[model samples]
Target: MSLVKRIRDISVATLNDKIENAEDPVRFIDKYLQTQKRKLTELEKLYQQTLTHAHSVKQQFMEAESNRIKRENQAEVAVKAGEEQLAKLILLEKMQSEEKSEQYRLLYEDGKQTILELEEQIQNLKDEVQELVDKRAFYEAKIESIRLQKQLNQVNRFIEKQNYYDQSRSIDQKFSELEMQTNALREVRSNDTKTGSSFGGKLQSEVDAQFQQLKKKLEKER
Candidate 1:
């Protein structure tokens, strides 16, 4: 495929979608960047070679034109010396050289145009490479930032959960202590009731004995 076409394809690729779907996004991005760099290098080499070829063709055209002019000068000198046949032969050679020079000149012009286009394409590819490099760095940093934010969120959730657990444990301990205090209070109340009943029964028995003795003393006095 043409280099420009290939670069265009790469430039318009759905890289974000590819990265999102990739199992190893970072690795995928690295590989993709490397491929682009290699393509850029190849395109640069081709551009240089095209420029060199254009220069060579231009030199060829100049040399041919120089030879054609030399031949024309020689033909004029021959005609001045009254050598018509020699002048005719040199004129014919000069025409042939002129034709060759014209052909080379046309080729050189075409080459020059091609070189200009190649240079433009090479510059475009360089710009694309630079843009991609910047994009790669931006994406890498963004991914890292997202990862850090996720980690921070996870840590925050863990801390929240731990605090909840601690509070639950504290509540449970307080409830257990309240339950023990309630039981202790019930036990103390039960003991106090039993002691009061025992004391009241003993006092009633002593009063009954005193009343019986007073009744017997009054009967004896009667």
Candidate 2:
């Protein structure tokens, strides 16, 4: 295996574990996402550089191959024209071109492989960042739900307290009404007693007058 075949792998296991075990998941996820984004940016830049280098190497290889083919044809033409020395020189150039072409070919292949690995790493980084974003959203929603529930509970307690107050007020009003009725009954009894005393005095006076008349008539008869 070529040394270029070894690409650094991106790992998110530690970050994921930290996020899962964090006391403040929201804050942890935010920081983790930012870090992942920065890493992704660096990896993307590296991938672009690798791709450019690979293209340059491929171009060089193609140029070298074309030169080799041209030199081969030139060498053949020189030999046919009875120019032995010139043909020898052209053959040497062709060999050099072949070597150069091979070297560039190897370089281009290595660059391409490196680019592939970098792309994979970049994709993984992106995936991890996206996962963190989703987690952040989930945490935000959960927090909102908790806030709403708390508000609902508070409102329920307020309503219960208001109902209790209203009931107490109602009982107080009923008690006041009962007290007023008792006072009115006492006033009526007092008025009835005064009227009965006046009627009894008038009856006693009439009886006394009738008894005196009967006694006076009996004395006259004696």
Write the residue-wise lDDT of candidate 2 on 120-155 in tens digits: 777766766877788899988988999999999999
TM-score of 2: 0.74
Model 2: how far residue 196 lies from native, Å: 4.5
Candidate 2 — which pairs collide? Answer: none
Quote the lDDT for 100 in model 1: 91
State the lDDT of candidate 1 residue by residue for 17-118, as single tens digits: 787788867677788878878887888898788878988888888998998999999999999999999999999999998999999999999988888777
The alpha-carbon lDDT assigned to residue 149 of candidate 2 equals 100
